[model samples]
Target: MLIHPEEILETINMVTHEHLDIRTVTMGINLRGCSHPDVATFNENIYSRIMRCAENLVRTTEDIQSLYGIPIINKRISVTPIAIVAESCQVDDYCSVAETLDRAAQQAGIDFIGGFSALVQKGMTPGDLKLINSIPQALATTKKVCSSVNVATTKAGINMDAVAMMGHIIKQTAELTRDRAGIGCAKLVIFANAPDDNPFMAGAFHGIGEPDCVINVGVSGPGVVNSAVRALQNPSLGDISECIKKTAFKITRMGEMVGKEVARRLNAQFGVLDLSLAPTPAVGDSVAAILEAMGLESCGTHGTTAALALLNDAVKKGGAMASSSVGGLSGAFIPVSEDEGMIRAVQRGSLSLDKLEAMTCVCSVGLDMIAVPGDTSPATISAIIADEMAIGMINKKTTAVRIIPAPGTKVGDMVEFGGLLGTAPVMPVHNFSSETFIARGGRIPAPIQSLTN
Candidate 1:
């Protein structure tokens, strides 16, 4: 069978003109067998396993990119969460493990290596606590290692104590990398209902249940959707939704095709295709721009949330039609630093922390890439996260917090992380304290909505 000419041309236009591309092709490797009684042997085994599994990853992806002429932006790896795998070891910290992972990633030409993480939705074990404590040092020392902590899930409810601790951890991470405007915080994500097979970094982890090895693809194209929305002549909201759905279908088709090709080449199981409208720092490629094209005065205006909900639902519908293997945080991301339109909106007073939180209720993830004041208290940060986690629990959806306390930076200051992470303006937070409420360390019971059984 031959490729359809019209479809081929359409894809070319999407890539060469509209900025559609495969955001990441991540290899998920199970490292359970690498665990050993001796920490040194354990580290060696871990490194060797990763290198063996992903040795050809970068070269294979490059070959596929040339073969298909699609831009595969990042080649990454997600391993089994280090906490569980390293639990038997007597080491006090996982910093050495993080270094080994970083070295392995560099050798394999991986852009980011995820799974330095812990799951403490209900409570923290010794391993979990150690991993959490070591995160600041681990992340601070490594270049490519990404970290995440899941402190809440829908059924088990929010872990307020862990939430409180992460606030301090985030601050410490920021301080550790303060010379770079706390860019380390950008690599750390705290989650409620975080997915296992996500291809995106700062949150990607090969779940304990996932296969030994698999390839997951992240497809991104906020620009294409923006163009499609703007192409409609005086379109209504319904028209815009249909347009977005159609665009998402096309983008996802490109993703599924690329992912299959890459998996076939790499001899790996094809995992999910994450169709998130993840924006870059580039001018035209922005999720917030797509929102603006949908007749929003600004990204955080009254109808912005409704418009986002529609866009998100329509994108999901379209992507589902294109592929059955859709997973991860597959929705439009509203990260302030990552999207130029979002940054502009914040700079112009059209968006704020409250409005972003409101928007997250209807989308995937929460308060991503938002920069708060330097002096923002850890209790306050924890309170912000508690509110977000509650939303996820009640709605039975995934939500994450990746806010940065830009050290020595206050409101109206701009933090430059550069490249794909972009830059963020320090947005104002509510001065009122949530101190006492956050200090009351206890689990918030799962909402009735979580009782789907």
Candidate 2:
């Protein structure tokens, strides 16, 4: 894992000028072993387990960052999905468990802790129902806890019942934290065909198949990609794509090297490297800017989906060449709020809900970090989610939605979340009712694509 002297300088340039950084070095801890029927006992075991496992996570990440002169932006933890672990406990509310996770994350000095979640792609169990009900209070009260629910899978099909419930849950979560601009909704996601080893927030959780403990890395370099694109002078489409691939190869190599070092220091198994060019609020560090750099007038304008398809495919191909193990949501994330270019596009009236939905077909996550009107009906939200889930289920790709129904907000108003969450402009939803469609609560059978031998 020796980096050449010249490669070190290139890495330095990527960090200093292009904002290249390791987005997260997430440690996944399985809590299945700690499950207990008693709520209080389960809470104690959960807290102690996380604290003991991730006590040195922050310090170790800092040491590695200083050693490599690379900025590691977030140190995080993703545990086994809470719904599964809490199923044994006879609890009416899983809010206490969420509090335990928050406290453990705070004690360990991690930025965020994921896995206050359930998978109801087929149907809901008593514990899954309880955890879903607790999401509103859990997100509102916890400082750094994140929740996700998988309501659809390619094999199990679309769970209309779960999808319908999530719409109400999302709105309630937003309403509960309306004072903070409905920030709670930013920490919750609904997914279809969700990946198990994702290290990104709002959708990250250690799957049942994962080992007891592991280290997963999420690498980000939107700015680097932007810079690479900018350096090109009137290049053709094929030339530009090749340039992106080379840049991605180098970025993924650095991520793999850093991930191995972190896993070794923590005595944990190295899992996967997520090569998602996740955008930020910063000017140059945006996925939309990269798209614009490819000659698009705006991110949501015509040809945006085709451009995203190219970028997503190139990054995956290049990263695959650099690392033996690459998984998770490995693509460009086009979250409107998180990406400055996308926010500008929305503000200018070029990006609409429909166009964003179209882009999600090729992007990382669906309807991510979007803000809708407070008056938006729960059934409409469910319908929106159903559309997105159907896309993923049919295509056999991961798709997720994290929409914020900011209370008392309209299409033009802006809600500033600051930091990484950024500010969101409330976008208008279609004024049509889909109540009847959502009321048909049952499983939408799996797509024919799922019958792969």
Model 2: residues >4 Å from true position, as ranges?
1-8
TM-score of each prediction: 0.98, 0.98
Give the alpha carbon lDDT tens digit for every residue of 1-453 in model 1: 889999888889989988899999999999999988688999999999999999999999999899989999999999999999998888999899999999999999989999999999999999899999999888889999999999999999999999999989999999999888888899999999989999998899999789989999999999999988988999988898889999999889889998998888888999999999999988889988998998888888889999999999999999999999999989988899999999999988999899999999998888899899999999989988998998888888899999999999999999999889989999988899988988899899777777888
Candidate 1 vs. true structure, TM-score:
0.98
Tens digits of lDDT, candidate 2, 1-453: 887999778778899989999999999999998899999999999899888888988999999999988899999999999999999998799999999999999999999999999999999999999999999999999999999999999999999999999999999999999999899999999999888999999789999899888999999999999999989999998988999999999899989999999999988899999999998899899998999999999888999999999999999989999999899999989888899999999999888999989998987878899999999999999999999999999888999999999999998999899899998989999998999999999999988988887
Question: RMSD for each model, in Å, please?
Answer: 1.1, 1.2
Per-residue error for 235 in candidate 1, Å, reads: 1.3
Model 2 scores a C-alpha lDDT of 0.93
Off by over 4 Å in 1: 1-6
Clashing pairs in 2: none
lDDT score, candidate 2, position 10: 77
How many residue pairs clash in all the candidates, one count each? Answer: 0, 0
CA-lDDT, candidates in order: 0.92, 0.93
